[model samples]
Target: MSKRKLRVGLIGGGGIAQAVHIPGWNNLPEAEIVGVADLSEATARKAAAIAGTKEVFTDFHELLKLDLDVVDVCTPNKAHTPAVLAALESGRHVICEKPLAVTTAEVRAMGELADAKELKLMTAQHQRFTQSGVAARAWVDAGKVGEVYHARVRAMRRAWLPPSPGFIDGKLSGGGPCMDIGVHALDLCMWLMDFPTPVRVSGTAKTVFAKGHDMPNLWGEWDRERYSVEDFASGFVHFDNGATMVLEAAWMCHQPDNEELMAQLFGKQGGLAWPEATFSTATNGIFAQGTLTPTTQVPHPHWNEIAAFADCVLNDKLSPVPWTETIKVIGILEAIYASSNTGAEVAVKG
Candidate 1:
């Protein structure tokens, strides 16, 4: 008596695909993963097992031949553009992992293609689905944080460098922590600020501790020879609306905290910070501070993200995290690297 479930095909069966994405799809009763494709047959089989489907393929293009309503791309950062383009051209809605594309141009092309095809395309910015993020957004939207003019964003880890060629290699990962965890806090802050247009950026990306043995990694030893990306990056952004932001990302630092992912916003009326959901302001001419509490916890933010994407696709709703927003995020990141290379403030083209 029920209509058919939305058929899905997965494009890369790596750790993210197997651990969160596939499981997220399995949680949606209105969706069913029909097939999985990975370069490794073993990885494909492992993901297909989780999807409860034996259909597996080594090439994603082969899986695209099937009747699929959606394609979930869990590939490495550099591979996201190609996979997303192929999926959109195949007449399938797409949900891709974050830092959707390394370059703003690549994101624009993919976004334009999806627009022409009239397909739903969402970037997997799972942090937005977190309780803290959701709560902060609500407060900001309610004018609690009025006219935010500046923000401090950080995604620093003491010694949690990812141990993989896909992340360490510049050709694969595009950059370093700036693309990895930095995108998380940056995206959240920008979203809360209603996505200001970044006009210019000055940044520095360096291999301070990654290429040396001074700092030991908590995630175990990685190939220092293959590590071609920056271990630390800092940037300053000026927006069209006169708003400013300070961004910092690092895989390894001399900090005591294991991690310190934060986004602190300063506004005309008040100030707020995330990953803590705390706020400060002057009410009735007196100083006041409070913590924004989550009405409910998101047990699995990735699952909530998947559900939202599927809902938008099935119901003709707007993409919860559209490529338009993602392009802006990528533009800022791209400008950071460009500024670092040229030793000058780089203009971000909208």
Candidate 2:
């Protein structure tokens, strides 16, 4: 007798879906992508072919009707709340891409509904599954860096702005680099800090370069008229624990490196930087600094994230990236935008 395979359905057959997500699901022998749904029939068909499934639906509602144990949402930022809520209403576990939703209210609604329905809801923050991320988490958990006081996060690119309406358009994407790449580093930093409650936030968001032809984009040119979102954003956060953080993100910047994605934590006992896994501390009146190597290396963080989610579902365990933690992240981000708009420090409502 063979074990029954988990039936999976995917919503939104876009680039991320075809590139990493479809491959991640296919890598799991115990999981089967039973259907794929997209607004475009051609994209649905293409993703269905990649998933080794003939079932394709132009409407995601039709995909939800399938006997799916899990729903993978790869839709645009604006579509996440509805799709995730609908999937949960249909009695399916859901895993949504980063930023979960644009607003804290939407995230809370989905999270509360999932709790009421006793279904697992996870956010696909893949950076937490990376080799360096895992090592840094373990190191922090072991009390290497005690009493974290402040942190710095950055997700700056020289000129790699995504040339898509789903990203650059404010209506579709909600925010700019703050919502796109900034969420990646911000989430990682908050997770490392064990999800401190953000009490207040002061920020600035500006359309510095996307509107002009001064900076040539590395990813190709985008529509200047359609570019409504900010090209750069920065925020200062105050946590409930009296800890503070500085976050900076940009799609175009005059920086030396092509890109510099970092999250550095400063603590009373030590300081640590992620991706690099470098740490500094004074032991026995001697200064010590070294790079921490992960005991295990994850070649594909997305695949590992999928596997982790699957493991939790199979064993009836909690979501690997629960919504409770996600809400805090979204709250801070929402406040950043609000602060930017009002030109005043706004209270983070979590």
- Taking all chains together, each candidate's TM-score versus the true structure is 0.99, 0.99
Tens-digit lDDT track of model 2 for 163-210: 999999999899999999999999999999998899999999999999
Clashing pairs in 1: none
lDDT by residue for model 1 (57-155), tens: 998999999999999999899999989999999899999998899999999999899999999999999989999999999899889999989999999
User: At residue 329, what lDDT does model 2 achieve?
Assistant: 88
Clash list (residue pairs), candidate 2: none
Model 1 spans > 4 angstroms off: none
